[model samples]
Target: MLIRLIYASRAKSLGPMDVKDILESSRRNNTAAGVTGALCLSNGVFLQCLEGDRVVVNALYHRILLDPRHDNPAILDFEEIIHRQFGAWSMGLVSTVADNQALFLKYSTGAQFDPYQMRPQALRAFFTELMGNTRWLA
Candidate 1:
């Protein structure tokens, strides 16, 4: 079954080189594991959308959580979906670092604080952005 593992985390450092190295390993592992998705780093936050079977997705999720490169990780999105929204991306879409203004607007939602908190507004905005941008990984 196809599922998406969407997560965002605060980076330990904001250096571009640091971000590159941190993401490279995850990107390579996803490819090797036959997982398709996208990874985006912006404003010290690393966001990724991954797709694959139950085992691969779960394993990848666990690996990310344990990776100490990021601290106080927050999983912004995660759930089982009936369709694949990021079928085009090999690792789907890695977003560039968003500016402070953009980041503020993105996370300005009034949803609940918990990661697993289900809020329609926040979820809608995220998926809408992901769906609207066809060239996410470009």
Candidate 2:
């Protein structure tokens, strides 16, 4: 029983090394737990998607909920999936502080990437497109 979970949260101040550390930890832990996902950080906000067994994904999400680096974590979408959309990555990462103008425009209605304002399918579309376009951390 595979599932996909999408979530958004407000992040704390993060330097490049902090993001790298987070991604490395995620890659290591997710690999061990047989989970895959993508994480996007933009303007102190985080958008992430995780796919794997229901138990594994859910447990990972709960752990993310407890992490002090982010606040007000909210699950945006959760559903059973036929296949992994992010199968190639243990944990893919993107930061809007970089060159992601097109990505932001497509997903954001205004000048910011606020997942809370998006419709459900629109939110899912954003993640899907992100997974397809962005290079994952290796």
Residues 1-138 of candidate 1 have per-residue lDDT tens digits of 777667767667456576566556656776687777666555455656677887889887887787767877666666777877666545544454342234334544433123234354565466556566434433
- C-alpha TM-score for every candidate: 0.68, 0.91
Clashes of 1: 10
Q: For model 1, how big is the CA root-mean-square deviation?
A: 4.2
RMSD of each: 4.2, 1.6
The stretch of ten residues in a row with the least summed lDDT in candidate 1 is: 109-118
For all candidates, what are the clash counts?
10, 0
Q: Mind sharing the TM-score for model 1? A: 0.68
Poorly placed runs, candidate 2 (over 4 Å) = 135-138
Q: Model 1 off-target regions past 4 Å?
A: 92-107, 110-121, 134-137
